[model samples]
Target: MDFENFLKKLKEKDRVTLSKVITLVDNETKEGVEFLKKFYKERKDSFRIGITGPPGVGKSTLLNKLIERFAKKYDSVSVVAVDPSSPFTGGAILGDRLRMENIYKFDNVYMRSVASRGSLGGLSSSTENILQVLEIFGTDVIFVETVGVGQSELDVMEITDLVIVTLVPESGDSIQAMKAGIMEIGDIFVINKSDREDAYRVSEYVKSILQMKYQDKELTPPVINVSAKNDTNIDELVSRIENLKEIFIQKGIIERKREIRRKKEVREILRDMFIKSIDRELKIIENKNDKDVSPYEISEKILKNIDFKSLEDIWKER
Candidate 1:
């Protein structure tokens, strides 16, 4: 692909070109890395929100409502829905797009589905790269909907400006909601399907837990009850999101988060590059049919041959 032409077309707001560039980036092609290295500095400011929860929690329905509201309010809105990948084929059904088919009619709304590819974090490994590409494409708001997650899948908190944890009346008892991993990561707790009889009770229970957890902190995560199917209290939820975003901006929280994210991204990139450079050595070690050699001894041998000073200098130059 001619990256120069692609960039030009991207500036023209060509959705086709935008999709092509995203595919290139998502696949982590050499051209994609080059394109990012050339233009990542030009990324526009955008708010990233993560929606995550266990299965059958109405996350997609809630996200669809949020997108509709954001699309009307913002100049441009984008979504990345991470779906579970098939273990055998490594392909995803991409069903979130079908659930949110109505939003496609808006010219300002763009959505993409990505396979989680066995990432334990509930997000795709390329999620941050895709978000950056969308930022460069001029989005005002970006929403990332993660695959159905268990308790420890909290990686979304690292990359998003804020995380909304969606739940339903049938999710679990108050004891289940008090778990440390998923509960600790939420900036906002949403009870979808609020029309159900137990929805209010669940919301109140969550609020009490949050109050105790954040009593000393300046900001406490709010629990809101909304029925996505009935379109209940969605406007209020949107208002709360906007309000929290303002506070985050004013407190420089978003900037701090992005700085941390950038540092981690650099480390990850260096690790990946270093591993690829040692692929041949790793293969040679693997092919050795020695039954007596321990894995630790093999690793030590590999480490002995690597020049740390040279690698450090190379990294500094970059």
Candidate 2:
């Protein structure tokens, strides 16, 4: 369908329309880009949770568990699961939600699987756009589950009100999570697969590290052990997550973090605009026989009036 019709229907609170619009956004077409612009204009704070860890850390299972528990409390929830993108096909595999069978059918649950597109940032531009779209729809909680962890998951770290780093006892994440940067990424931590041995050890390890690191800070991250497959401690986990949400608000850091995220979003938008203008300049050069200037030539001309050699510096960096 046309963009106008899609927008009209999506704005009317129809799930089917929003689902179609989400597919469009997933494709990242020109219409999809426009839809995102309209989508973000209505954006507000949605309860965003990032569940991330290395592969096979029970992220999907934990996500499914959280969906069941959270859906009971929230009126509506949106989930964005990031999967590996095909290097050749230029699309995401979208496999992260294959295990989230039950939540997909709930009218209150909307989940979309996104391909990572090999972006080092962990989140593609479209992933960020989709999260904002969920917020626009007024979802009570928006969960973003990343396939792998590390610095890339840090992208979600900036945007979410709470970050849950999920891991099993034997995965060595107990040690990995203590890395200075990793510890800072989570507001709360989850030791999934709690039925396994050393789950409490992992929890104790996290706590000891938190005490050492935050010797002066007011709040330290909380760790919970839960078995996603067996549904053990799921309700308590949900309640703890809800509690952290208020702690974040009380500290006033969440709003500050979001302000920085907004700044980065604006910078990306401006960068995209400038890149498109350069592409347009190149196209004009390609079509014209003699007089039209290449993007480099146009850049030189634009920079000539300024004495700082801006284009020259940019070229040097490239």
Candidate 3:
């Protein structure tokens, strides 16, 4: 189908077409690029939330409960649950949907599982673009759940309005969390499996760290305890999330954050183009008798071939 018709179907909430569009964009096809260029401008509003943490932290269960709360309050909600890529197939197990099976019956709730695809920070290469596609699909709120790959989970902060870092009592000491970079990314910290013996200790440890980190700031991040299995403290979590949204708006940080993310996206695209161009140049050198030349000399040749002036112009134009 034509891009225009596909967009129309997207607005009409056709699941099949939406799935196709997501797949096309995930592959970064020409059609997908065109589709994003045409429709992304119209998507000016949507709240994005990122949920990330270590493996076996009950992130999925917590998200499912949160989605239930969000569904009732928002017009439409969608999820992008990222999974680890299989070494053999380079595809995700896509098991998050199974965890959230109960919410499948809700028409307003759209869920998709994405493979990490070797991208660091537990996100897929296409995740940023897919957010634009979801915006075009008339989703009010979107949730991005990372693959829970330790320090790599920080990338979710680039795309989300609020970042929730879920942890269990067994996740370890506060110093370890800080070292893992989870301490820096969490806008809100959730201690799941609160019934465990060490849950309070973990929460206390995090609270002390937050106090030390944000002592000079007016807004300090909150750490809450919850048991997703028992449906406990979920309402409080929902309230905290809503409150943080208001706080962000009042602080006027949301627009500034978006601007920064846009610049990062532009740089990422340029970096990709540069890498591809260099790879093509390298292939020619590899086919020739260039082994006599130093690696530095070959790199110099690649740099000389690049149109730096054109690159500057492209950067300036956009």
Q: For candidate 2, lDDT tens digit of each residue in 166-242? A: 76798556466446666677777788898998889878887787787675454677788899899999888888887
Q: What are the clash counts of all predictions, listed in order?
A: 0, 0, 1
| Candidate 3 ranges beyond 4 A from true positions | 174-177, 216-218, 307-318
Model 1, which residues run further than 4 Å from truth? 148-152, 174-178, 216-218, 307-318
lDDT tens string, model 3, 144-232? 99855664566899888889999888875544745447788889999999998988898988888888888646478899999999999
What are the runs in model 2 whose C-alpha is more than 4 Å off?
1-8, 38-41, 88-91, 173-178, 216-218, 278-318
Q: What TM-score fits each model?
A: 0.92, 0.81, 0.92
Q: How many Å off is the CA of 104 in candidate 3?
A: 1.2
Return the lDDT, model 3, position 306. Answer: 79
Candidate 1 matches the true fold with a TM-score of 0.92
Model 3: colliding residue pairs: 121-152
Question: Lowest-scoring 10 consecutive residues by lDDT in candidate 1?
Answer: 309-318
Residue 139 alpha-carbon offset, candidate 2, angstroms:
1.1
Pick by TM-score: 2 or 3, better one: 3
Clashing pairs in 1: none
- At residue 11, candidate 3 shows an lDDT of 86
User: Rank order by lDDT, top first?
Assistant: 3, 1, 2
